[model samples]
Target: MKSKIKAAFNPRTWWPKAKDGMHNMSPLVAFFLLNLFLVWIKTYINYLVNFNLGVTGPIQNFLLVLNPIPTAIMLLSIGLYFRGKLSYWLIWIFNLIQSLWLFANILYYREFTDFLSFGIMGSGSATGNNLGKSIAAIIHPTDYLVFLDLVIILVFLLLRKIKIDRKGIQKRYAILTILLGLILVFVDFGIANVDRDGLLDRSFDNNYIVKYLGLNEYALFNANQTYQQSNTRKKAGPKDLQKIQQFVKENHSPANVSYYGTEKGKNVFVIHLESFQQFLIDYKVDGQEVTPNLNAFYHDQHTKSFDNFYNQVGQGKTSDAEMMQENSLFGLNSGSAMVKYGASNTFESMPGILGQMGYTSAAFHGDVATFWNRNNTYKSFGYNYFFSKEFYPNANKPSYNVGYGLKDKIFLKDTAQYLQQLPQPFYAKLITVTNHYPYDLDKENISFPATKTGDNTVDGYVQTAHYLDQAFGELMDYLKKAGLYDNSMFVLYGDHFGISENHQPAIAQLLGKDKVTDYDLGEFQKVPFMIHSSDLDGGIDHTYGGEIDMMPTLLDLLGVPTNNMTIFGHDLLSAQNPQIVVFRKGGWVTPKYMKYNNHYYDTQTGEELYLSKDKELAKEAKANDAYADKVLSDSDKVITGDLLRFDKRTDFHKVNKKNYDYSKKATLKALKRSQETNPSSVLAKNDGHSTTDEYTTDAPEYSSSSK
Candidate 1:
């Protein structure tokens, strides 16, 4: 019976035990246990960070089940070591396999570099913050974990050499391994049960394994709630549709009347200036000017300057700005919306709308069309032609290198030539590319005119801007000479804020201050949006607007009938409400206040704006939260392909067919329909919720109360 029991416990009992058996066992066990713990920790952390655990319960459970492989390997290694035949070659092989597997998994997730960057020091390392360091520390643990494990094995071997037989110790290790294996198997089965019910309604809370694990339950709960909310939006009832329709009907105005321009078959030129900011024009350098041409244009032209305009580019930066401006879609939160959605043929855009109106449409960029996948996006957006670096003659030859493309001068000249060649009444989008990063003009070998003066880098940027300004002047002059100026509309806007700390400092110096208190870190993102035409009546219009509003506003001005399906933007000339600009960085800037995520910043001081008395600030906070929820919900629809179905069903005229002459009959009909459908309007009135009452009247006013 004793022999049988011993045989069951140890298969190696028939073989003679080596002196180093005990010595090898400890190091092997320690290494195995430490690695096992690390693998489990990493798996848990990755699930927490990437996937919402509550929503991905099944996946999480599966990961947990798989988490024991490393540990099992380590345990097997320990048994081999305790067999007194542990080879250095076998240990090296195991280490190599583990290292390669870890690296392979990391690379597969595109996080290998991130892992190595935490003082691990590997090629193509992607360094993050302290979070990365903590993760690395957990993965490797301490040298002692491995050293002690090896030391224990060595100790057993040493003891055995000194005439100590440790047969009982081996029997104890066998029992311990079996117990651990059984425990892990049971845990894996438990996790599997939760995973199996992950998609069920009960799985939301009942089958949420992470909740039991006490790992980021709040985040998991929030994720589940978000998913439910998204489903609610998707499965909106007839009542919800009616509410939306009523909202549009009551707020809607005649497109032409609302946009402040008569409908005509005018050629539209949209220039998206890269990284151009409002401060560039307003800022003065050494008691002089940084952007003399832009300043002069603002002053001399029939300009309507929007003092409260804000930039709302999402994570996609330039592409996001373009998408917001032209597509009338909200900015994306995660990926490049333009690139992702642009490739699909189903996506609708403003250029596509214009193209439907029998106008030739084109997009011009001096850079490669492949950059940001503009070529595919533009084509999908119904552009008949795309002029990129490939279209430029001798573009491969060495010239002044701007940020992402050829010099501004070359881009401007090429764009102008293309525009001149295009058919009349064409919709042309010109994206300029001089004012990008590295801000070094001398490095690019670009020279300015004799009329300009400053340090080479500043002078180079100034010169580049001047060159573009001259190009603009030349284009307008040509149009005038050709008698096309009166029929063409020029819409110019900046893609983003310029990268010039020197310009900011220069502005501060000119103002005789260290920093502009009114300008916050977020304020640097703001750029200019202007619409200029020689034929239209011009005045200073301090209108608050953003990139998303551009398309609807322009479409309205062009006398194109638009529906809610066309855009989220309201007509800038309509009597709608005060404008709000939202950023992907989770902040919004209005005329009176700047709101970050859950916090409001004082517009002037850039400090946290709060109430000294009572819970008035709390009420505002609630409203802000609601606003954020609405915005995010609306944005998510567009990003997640839910909005694509509306493109096919929408007929702009079906919703917008009003009296062209603003007749009372049409107005009365619209009013009656609006009144019948709008329960929210009644609710708002009953609640005394007026836009003017909510915000301070002393805040900077826009030219129109619309947007």
Candidate 2:
């Protein structure tokens, strides 16, 4: 009994005891350390190069290199339990997993400048789209370095340079390694908190978390956050909406007296200009207009455009813009609310609100229904119809489809047929995707000259934008010929920024600037937003607003009041609106001042403000800063907790998911069924004849399959 007791506590009893200190580690322990070191190095390099944490000072720089150690140890230690070759193999597997995760973030950061979150993985449908091609388009050759160590290890094993460990590690030593990792984690956290106060509690930006800690640590933090959000939503009830209700009442913008209900009962058409930036408007290259058609439309007599309309979106990008436009709420601070909560969360969305007034809401996108998990999200929005990729005959063909979705010209031509089938007063959204990132257009379709900005990313931009403009012009002509133009209200807006900060030098070249300041980038966030309806008095209204203002603005025009609604946006046409545009990152832009990266800038002159010298200006900036913070926090809370599901002032039922059938057969059947009952559509109005023939395109790839 005494011998057994001694052996239980002795390290040599379970693990192979070789030597002391340097040579004391068994093969199992050595393997764990090897993989941990590899993972640590790869993660550190990726963070420095790919993840833009805005490394500002010495402390943050140190933390950036040191933050991944604890996570690497914790993760690699899991493989130590198995004995023999399996243990070694498991450690290799873990090393591969860590490298793959880092690689994934590199891909994501290229597009969003953000890290991966639990919601992306938790929602399995997020992976169902043509992710392979999108991934291929973004990945650089250097990104393959992440898997170098894995290949090295495999080669070493095959060449008999590294032996498979036959013995298992002692449990006590495994616990000790994990405890050491935990101790280091605490030390790292303390240092981070010292560098940035409230580092964990109030840091809304993912970059701050990753800057202070690490990507692996951020993943853990995001997982906890996602869990907390889900649990909070589950525990929410009607009583919890009081604060939201009170807040909305205090901040709500009254409807503009001049425009309220002016376009009531008009057919609503929202044209989603994907990845389009306002700089393209009247932007001439060598005196040649890049988007001549759109520029003409922007200055049309009946168009009410906003030159200063910024797109307020974060990691969710296009989806974030959609949420703000449709629901009048900001997205989740960490992940996409659309991808995370769209299927389950209750929303007082545009479709749901307008449905009560007999509007048949439908969305048209050339992409597959599951691209952003929209198949499920559209149902939550109470959309009566969704015409997605399967509805477009040749959408899957290589000629029709690019990396994102179908070509714009083909999509616009195909969709005219469907547009004629929707009922009268329909709320239709047409999403164009030819101008998306990595702008790839066939040689035959390139009608405009590419920019010679010495940046490949921005070079092909104008060409695609020109193509989209052509498509846009064709669709508009169809709308007129089909008799759907004069009676409808058209809302055209760019979804998000086309060129991210990653290609700043090219952007600077395009704009003829030597370098881009954060202030300039703040202004660069502006996207085109125009409201056009024939015979309506309109002009270029220079209002400082963001996508969040879309819902309230449209509602006001439709003679709707948002008294009981929980919304954070102000109508753009109302004088009561605080015209301070708030970005998802804890920064804001006003006509007088712009606050970004924890610094203030003069909005007009692009000069940085020194708070020590400008006391009066500082005071006003602080007030706007606080107001914007509250707006963002409150909006985030509403989305995260799904508090709107408990709206008490009205008895409107939540969207019944069963009633929304997105299948092609059901969509056609429903349109036909509605025609028999209502007979209010353009096709019904035209004596049941097709109107698709009116859409004529000069697209080089246009064929019968596309038509």
Q: Which candidate is the best by lDDT?
A: 2
lDDT per residue (tens digit) for residues 70-185 in model 1: 24444344443443334322443444444344433333222111121111121111112322432342242332232343445455545653222223234455564656666664
Worst 10 residues of 1 by lDDT: 693-702
lDDT of 2: 0.84
Q: lDDT, candidate 2, residue 301?
A: 91
* Cα-based TM-score, every candidate: 0.59, 0.90
What does candidate 2 score in Cα RMSD to the true structure? 3.9
Stretches of model 1 off by over 4 angstroms after superposition: 1-259, 443-483, 500-519, 604-607, 611-617, 646-707
